[model samples]
Target chain A: MDKSTKCALCPQKAVVHLKYFNRKLCKQHFSELTQDRIRKNISKNELVDKNNRVAVAVSGGKDSTTLLYSLANFAEKFPIELVGITIDEGIEGYRSESLKVVEKNYKKLGIEYKILRYENEVGKPMDEIVKKDQRLPCSYCGVFRRDLLNKAALEVDADKIATGHNLDDEVQSILMNYIRGDFSRLARTGTKTAADTGFVQRIKPLSVVPEKEIALYAMLNNFEVYWGECPYSHEAFRSEIRDTLNRWEERSPGTKYQIYNGAENLKELLKGAIGGAILFECEICGTPSPSVICKSCEMKKEVR
Target chain B: MDKSTKCALCPQKAVVHLKYFNRKLCKQHFSELTQDRIRKNISKNELVDKNNRVAVAVSGGKDSTTLLYSLANFAEKFPIELVGITIDEGIEGYRSESLKVVEKNYKKLGIEYKILRYENEVGKPMDEIVKKDQRLPCSYCGVFRRDLLNKAALEVDADKIATGHNLDDEVQSILMNYIRGDFSRLARTGTKTAADTGFVQRIKPLSVVPEKEIALYAMLNNFEVYWGECPYSHEAFRSEIRDTLNRWEERSPGTKYQIYNGAENLKELLKGAIGGAILFECEICGTPSPSVICKSCEMKKEVR
Candidate 1:
């Protein structure tokens, strides 16, 4: 019953009995456990390359924190270099809190980190856009975040941008896009978005772990993750999809895993089978888009 | 604009148009529009019978009420009796409100009505069974509804039971069932379920009308409708499908219609080619089922 007792899965539990938090897992297994999930997802997806430089998009949530921690560990052993990047969405409280955690975690890991503040780059903050449009906060946040993340990765000369999106998030997105007949987004939703050109390869290392597991891991590891809901997330259709899937998970355990596996199995067929030609390069930004322009540009104009 | 003036296509536009809540349509056109949808759907589908003693399951919702009203009108001039059977699911507030509308409409139309209440008939009320069981509400509701509807048709000496299900509901059910890999339901879901020994055929007259249009028609026609949401529907996954389709509709107005039509066109292949024996007669109930015992009986025993 001792709070300081060795964690159950810790190899040290068998000998020295050193406990980290309340878990019986030794520091080694605890580290390996988190790393194993990250590595397995990457290997299974064929996402990482030995010669590729990876830029980890760290938002300091459980997902991004765990992702950065694991990628840093993976880079120490692999032939790849891991660099951390953060996009300051300029949300007064949430982004600032998240950035503090990201920087603290990166400094602890001694990883090369870059922070791209939206105010400095986008010339307009998300708060202003959200207040003005009132129709789409995500329209602005998603576009700016993605653009900044990719731009940061390219600036650092990374060949791939590694995101902390877990299995539940990825599968929910796949299901959402598929349900909406958004074949273009559906085609690009897997762990590795293969056909995307003029953009660095995007990979999700935690694409197999469930949301609860990541939260638990982050908690057990004493990660300084900001436990707060995104203000704009309530209106997000993605949140609705998440809640919908979460409700399903409550009824049938491991449904999220099944959905993840189903999405993975579908990647091969969906790549070429959804035969519409929306995969043209954006003439302005050179990102994959259905039209001559990217969604970001379209949204910016649409919002204006 | 004179408020008393009716829109050219709608008769009771002054009263019913309020419920339709959308400005683009008038009362008569609303009803005609709903009927046109059903007719077009029925025409495109290879399942409706011009001479068969087709039964319509009257639930008293706007969709079913409209379906019953239209079916009565269509059958009056055609060679069909259009037997109207209502299954009482025994849900409080729901069945009663709907019954009022149904009974009133049936009385005005002088259509023969069959009401099968669940508790005295199905051995137990669904509300009671649901309290004891952890299975989904729809699971019990669907099973009890289907069996009772079939039994009602047989008792009334009819060939097919027609339900008020519309395009949006059908597509949602299809996607939900398909996602769960329920091939049997997929194979069975069409405009008309085929004939098997001891089992009455089933058809959907409102199969093409959208739920919104059905609501509009019900309001325009002075059919009393239950406007309250099902207390248990919050937990059902169909709403997610509906929302998904709605989002898709926002993106592309005709996607649901196209998808249903695609499935509608596949009816022949589903019946003749796919050839699932799951619809074979159940010895106990003399209904079509894969086993000698039907799903309802199996569930009943399991619950007990």
Candidate 2:
């Protein structure tokens, strides 16, 4: 271990060695740097405005837990209100334990919180839905989760919906869209916020931070972090891409950040090339969707 | 061996099984399909036009060998002239043998041929340049090769330069540029031709066909295919991406085509996003370039 190397700023023994930036940081400095990076991402993207009510999607995982904690800290400087929203996807052994972490953190932070369930909104739990249609549990879960997050944000009268999508997730998504030949999705990957009114503008504050660093920050801060995998989370394609990217990242230390930056530059360069999102009210649920009926409504019908 | 499955197009025993399309084709039909696909790509992208002279870049590999044959056949129907240009990069064992194959094919096809040497143009061969700067042999080789191709094409007065960049090469480049965050290169990947005057437009006739299919097609056509790898061809990152994509393609058929189609869609969608290329006369060489000095001229100075 290179523990003898002093921190970049102080004389403390460094705990974390960042290969990308070639900086050795101690525990205190590392945590401070992580938070500072998130603050910079938020400000650079204009994710939060003064007097804005933001709904943060907290899954009690390391990423969201870290994001919520960082945002709360940020609230001390900016005039912004944050509300915590957690979705109980009805996974028995998985979600219940993670929800406890969210509850504990929200209560301690003195933030208003809301817990929504799939059974309450979608008329069926994921456990039951997977039994009927065993093809795409992830597809069903994603559609419903996104729908609920938008609805929950609107219910709170929030101006923005924040998610714990760190750099790894964002870059993986960019690669996934490119591999799947989904050009529209590829074009829309790294935009700071959506421009539609019916949909709450989604902001990813941790988009610049790597997942490992977020986990480290969460551990350093003593937040309750759930390391459980979702029981219904099986995207084989995504897993393959993640493994490939992780291998590449291992080989080249700063690959994830390069991909993230490349994505942002591409998005900026092609802003006009990718046309505006033409959203319409879903006929059945009145949600905003490109098609006549939203994906959530279509999946709900199948589940029922 | 699945010898029991009959050919989908003919009564003869099937020699090739295309997993992507789930079709078994005999030798005769497979060759026909390969050529037809190339023809479709050419017509769809408007790669060739009437009364246009095309400089076909042939390296005596399976792809270029197959492309030359296809273009010779295509010229019979379309009122276009074909000329073959080979770049002898001065690789001792490699270029000398490949040039023989090009000579044989062009003579048999009745197409005019031209060969240029790097030592003559750049004042030094790649073999010697790699000794001095051992880091990026591929980069130096690429810059010189591209510059030579453009100059040779101009000498032949060809309206467009046709390259044998099959689906695998094109998709690999798309993923590479995306990974490296090279949006400009990504946006320019599959374009049939450039709009600049001094720069000859490039057309990739074999962009839709897979590499394996091209090799098979070359074998069926009895073309003298050079199976040697370039001595200086060591792109570790590209090799990794190629392996990953091949594994994905093996597990999921048609992944390459999807990636190719997706790249095309992305290029079209991001046309306005990636601004127009600004071309200025190079200070050292009067070539159209974005910078004051062209890449070839800069590289030539170093190589010399």
Candidate 3:
């Protein structure tokens, strides 16, 4: 982001410097590059194709907001139906505030959208759940929110559920599972998301895009986005990994990409063993799970 | 080590506290437990058994000396034939001094041993190779020594080549390759070593024991071991992993064991794809390699 540096693609002043590829870009070229990357990722992974309705999960955060805009443009350019799905976990000072940003974006973009709240969907909002459950808020909130999003997307008849999980998120998850030695939860097959049973095949169009670039994209475009951490969000394990990975990336750029590539290679190798892993229906909620009870249903049982 | 703490197994004063198992033991019981772990690991992994000739690669270091003793005691109890093999890399003052301690231990224990110097086996010793080669001494030294050990073990008609790789070494190697994303070399099958193409299978009897315990065992047993570091030894990546793993182990005990366990599970999953990987004989030295030329033969070519 040098003031005097020229864009790698043009003579305009470089506003964003991508350390991984050693590329500098101006506003226009940077937007184009970011959009092109997302478009290519979508097409390459077959995340969105002609006449397919994609439910883009937005959290009103920078990543999700940027993904909404990116996907909107992609929908216009290509022949795909687009819808926005936002889950309000009902955390105090967080969900209500961010919901406004998401609503504004949905209205402005003229996209069909649904906002599911934990209060209505799961009977207990995150604020209430946190006060009751001694466990970490994220432990159940994440599982609950993910389930709500998937169910909502499926209700809308969407063929795919695309999340705003950036490259940093993917790399952190890969390394996190690796460090914890949780091989079953590590990398597996089918592009980014391959679903069976009642699970909708999820996709990440912005998987290749780093989080910083998404923030920059949101800022450069002046998108109405709520850029704040959730009050109930305290994922200790993930935060540690995020800090370590960022420091490693600072010293060694493209380390994230290498990790992702390695995980993909590992997925192919693990494909056979994990590919046949069957999903069972939760006896309580009828959600596809590896056990008799889905995590969300278990959370619901605890809440009740 | 508590001043007045009683041994977990006996009334004697505790000398070593095993954090992983939360056990404290006296000098005698600690030795018994350490030996028990090694013996159990050997039997469980089937590293050594009755009537099989095993070559113990003794480098005169604490781990090797402890491993040598442990294996000898194991051999005596289990009816196995044991022979010591020492590789003299000729690292100036380092090797000559350590070789003396190894010879002393061999005579005291009445064990059959062979001291193979790099000068006689390969064209050049490590000291000379370090001077000529611009790469790290370990790059060539590791491959060359491994080849030499395999050949000597085969020459001695041994069933397996047992090395002094303790838990720390095993965990460090697992993390190093993992961090590097070198999955091909990460983890495979056959307990610790699965060999083909005239390659002697390798085994690590002390893979379950920590390095600190090895040092303590040597001290308690009063084994004649050369206590020093190799002047030519400086593994940057491994050192980094070692330091980080130590810090993690301090904060969260048994992190090392978890990593090792996770790797074993991963190995089982990866066994099918990697199990059939065929090793070919090097055209030059007729050693087993994935390529036409083995690493040792390639090094020989470079040396010549």
Candidate 4:
């Protein structure tokens, strides 16, 4: 925002100052740096490969929009095909608003995309489920969305399912699992590219980038990013963690990265000790799960 | 405070409501339950055995006061001799006020105890160090206090050193390490009975109980605990974490205990992977340390 401040790499006046990196950048270099990091995040983890078909879960949020755009840009020179998988959770105002942005962006990119609805795929619309279930909407929404995403990615034959989980989401889940004393959950919190039987490997190319950076990246590139809060809202504990982490990120700019990097290392160490994830096919739906029945089937049973 | 509410075990009116246990207890039953948990924590961990001389690090704060009193009370039936090890950081009014409570409680219990002054043992009073050094007093104070506790415990021929680290403190340290990505420190944060070479084993019997419970126990038993905050304060990140955790604790009553329990389990898992504590004697002073020289010596040298 400081026009007088020049870019750290170039003479162009800085458009955004990144506190975590302690650097200022112009529009040109900022995009270069962000995209470069995203590319590194993908290649380092081998989330995508030559001739591999990758399905990205794009919600039209700033994070997903940025990820889709970045991947699409990279795909121009690369041999990989990018498919956008957007889930219409049917949250009334929530899904309808973001759906427009998803369609528009996918159209501009001209990438093959699929739109999956909750009613068609998961047995119930989220709005109806909200009315019937006494539980918070997030608990059900997460299970359903993840279930739908995985299944849809498999249908399109995605070698890996790349998600738009930014660094904030990564750290928040890590801390939440820690708070819950669930080591197994904590171990699986990492953005692993490994796949088990009947499950598609999920990858996060934007896991290293901060949420703010994603917004800025979206803005500078003029991507159609939908900024909307869900009517049903977030998990309460998560909101607390997100706000606390934000304040902490402000207090010390790169604290989240440190925690996340440490978590990744710790997760590897835990997986070694706990023997990684011991997933099995759900008895009801044949989905890979820790328990006899997958959460998707369990929730569907509850709703029915 | 609810006089009409009957104790879960007895006819006496319940004085305390413990949400973690979801139980109401009378004055007598509450004491019994807390002390029972403390005793189990000690015995289960093998922190103290028959004929062991245990030196308790009593800060005269509610937590330490509760720990010392609990040990002293247990010593009546057990053969273990309880020695009170109090540290005077010499922070003007900070040590002066607490020192009185430490002495009074020690005398009342008729336990032989030793007081180690920071000036005598660590080569600097905290006040002078605070004035001379640019760093926060806490950074220096914690190292000095820990060092003095270890040395003083050794001099008293104590087999183990016990401290009043409650659940809140335990969970906070676990999270702080996680936040900082210091897995080594994270592994060492758990209450372990095993001591490294040339160091007295340290234990925390109060690790199971919450801070609020300790305060209630102190007040209910009329323990004469000192209530004061030092002019030189906590680490900034810790304060932020503590406040955030307090709010989280309110949001979900048993959350802190869950986190602490999970941390304890996770620490064990990490210790196995990381090969436990790798300590060496300080080259200069021959104290047990992870590095070539112990932190106490490093800090002592810095002050000099």
Candidate 2 Cα misplacement greater than 4 A, ranges: A1-6, A187-191, B1-4
lDDT of 1 by residue, A17-110 (tens): 2122334565567556667878877776678878788898988888998888777777777788888999987788788777787888889988
For model 4, what is the error of residue B263's alpha carbon versus the real structure, in angstroms, after optimal superposition?
Answer: 0.4
Candidate 4, pairs of clashing residues: none
DockQ of 2: 0.75
Compose the digit string of candidate 4's lDDT tens values, residues A190-283.
Answer: 6764465457888898999888888888998888889998898867778888998998889988989988998888877876676655778899
Q: After superposing the true interface residues, what Cα RMSD does each candidate give?
A: 6.1, 1.3, 1.4, 1.0
| Every model: Cα RMSD to truth | 7.7, 2.1, 2.7, 2.6
On lDDT, the stronger of 1 and 4 is: 4
Model 2 lDDT, residue A199, Cα: 81
lDDT of 3 by residue, A16-75 (tens): 888888888899999999899998888876777689898989889998888888889888
Tens-digit lDDT track of model 2 for B210-267: 8888988888878888988898888998898899889989989999888888878777
Candidates sorted by DockQ, best first: 2, 4, 3, 1
Docking class of 2: medium
lDDT of 1 by residue, B1-304 (tens): 3355566444544434322233445555555666776766666664456687877788777877777778777776667777778888778887767788788878888888899987866677777777888877777777878888888888888877788888788888766754664434666766777565446877777777777767766776677777776666644466656776786666556767766654454343334434456456666666778787889877767655
Best by TM-score: 2
lDDT of 4 by residue, B142-242 (tens): 88888889889988999999999988888888889888878877775567644654578888889988888899999999999889988889678788889
DockQ of each: 0.08, 0.75, 0.54, 0.74
For TM-score, candidate 2 versus 4, the one ahead is 2
True contacts kept of each: 0.00, 0.89, 0.43, 0.81
